[model samples]
Target: MADRNPGMDLDLEWVSGVRVNTQAVLKRAQQVQGRKVAKKEWQAAWLLKAATCIDLTTLSGDDTPSNVHRLCMKAMQPIRYDLLQSMGMHDKDITTAAVCVYPSRVADAVKSLKAANSCIPVASVATGFPAGQTPLKTRLEEVRMAVEDGATEIDIVINRTLALTGQWAGLYEEIRQFREACGDAHMKTILAVGELGTFTNVYKASLVSMMAGSDFIKTSTGKESVNATYPVAIVMVRAIRDYYRKTDHKVGFKPAGGIRTAQEALVWLVLMKVELGDQWLTPHLFRLGASSLLGDIERQIYHYVTGRYPAYHELPMA
Candidate 1:
């Protein structure tokens, strides 16, 4: 993992004065989408890199131990062995960065990974995940329980009411407490940008999350009406860049939800490489919070190798 972001004091001035030019952000996003994408070998390689950067996730009311075990197995071998060997990448030790599950399932995931003798960190969504509507005490307790259950990474959601009501200091304090609750686990703060109502709010939330020591600032909870979008991502990554400039500290970025295509994954990778440089391209600095994304990426790799797309049942489901 990259150096942990030792949060700094809240800067109300910076938070209040933030502004986003909607037209400019949209134009840049369009330009990024219009750029030529890699083909054949380059495309295959990029898809593999994207697989390694994924936080393979399973967050559902119906999630069971059987499914979680299957998810972990898929994460350990994200792509098919034959496909990797055909591409001369079988021995590269390629695997999803981590496996993310609900707080209750942290122990299950940890046990499965240990049984498999894999060190891929088990990430748990805590603090009333998807909706930070619970009381402060309950939320903090949730974080502690997930950590105690053997979760090495904690993805926490920020209360949208605080951001929407212009309570910058309140938001900072809450995230700081969550950071403390995370203990030794890395904290990935979910801003829920879709509900933040404006791009400026997203930028401020990003800065506040970093200030509160979030190891990674994520875009969505994968349960939002609007998930990761280029315009919103552009703003968040810029905040990361500016924060690094001011504090000489590097924080990570994760764009989650609705990223189901291999091409979309490449676009995010390109955005990171262009905005934050190659350093953020690593799993430590960047993560794609996705579920079905890995399946599509593997399918793309299969097509690249065998000169034909595999049938639906050809590749294992992720």
Candidate 2:
């Protein structure tokens, strides 16, 4: 694990001064998505690197212990052994960064990973996930319970009302409490960028979340109408770079939802490498949150080894 981000004091001046040029952000995002990606062996290798940073997630209402167990197994061995051996990476100990589930399923995920002797951390979404409309006491208790249930990381959703209303102090205090409730577990604060209304608001929310001690600033809860677009992500990472320059504290970034293909994953990796440099390229400072994204990544690997792509059922389902 990377060093924890012990948050700093809130600077309303810094938070309020944030301004994002929408047109400029869109142009930059286009350039990022337009860049040509590597092919053949290099593509295979970069896709494998993307696999290692995935937070293999199952956030469905119908998620069961059996499915969670299956998700855990897949996280342990994200790629087929033969596919890995074909690239001579079978012994690299490659696996998804972590297994993410709802707070109710944290125990089941922990049990499955433990029974299998896997060390991949269990992450649970708490604080009324997707919609953080719960009461303060209730949200705090939810965090504590998830931690006690063996969750090593907690993904908390910030109250968007504060951000939308420009209540910087209120937002800071709320996230600070969530950080405290996290205790030993790392906390990833979800900005739900799509709901923030404007790019400037997204940048301010990112700054405040980091000021309140969030280990990571995530793009969305994957439930929004718009999730994880490159323009929104660009604003968030720029805030991360700005924060790092000011406080010397490295905060991670996560772009969940709408990222479904190997090509999209490669684009995100490039976004991180180009915007935040090489250090943020690892799982320690970056993560991709998706349920079906891994399957396509695996399919791409299969195609790279073989001459063609395999049918959906050809690869094992998580």
Q: Which ranges of candidate 2 are over 4 A from the true structure? A: none
Put down candidate 2 lDDT per residue, 1-318, tens digits, no spaces.
578998899999888777799999999999999999999899999999999999999999999999999999999999999999989999999999999999999999999999999999999999999899999899999999999999999999999999999999999999999999999999999999889999999999999999999999999999999999999999999999998999899999999988899999999999998899999999999999989999999999999999899987889995
**Residue 171's lDDT in candidate 1:** 97
- RMSD vs true structure, all candidates: 0.7, 0.7
Residue 187's lDDT within candidate 1 is: 96
* Model 1, runs deviating above 4 Å: none
Each prediction's TM-score against the native?
A: 0.99, 0.99
Clashing residue pairs for model 2: none
Predicted candidate 1 versus true structure: per-residue lDDT over 61-99, tens digit per residue:
999999999999999999999999988999999999999
Judge candidate 2 at residue 11 and give its lDDT.
96
Candidate 2, 35: how far from true, in Å?
0.6
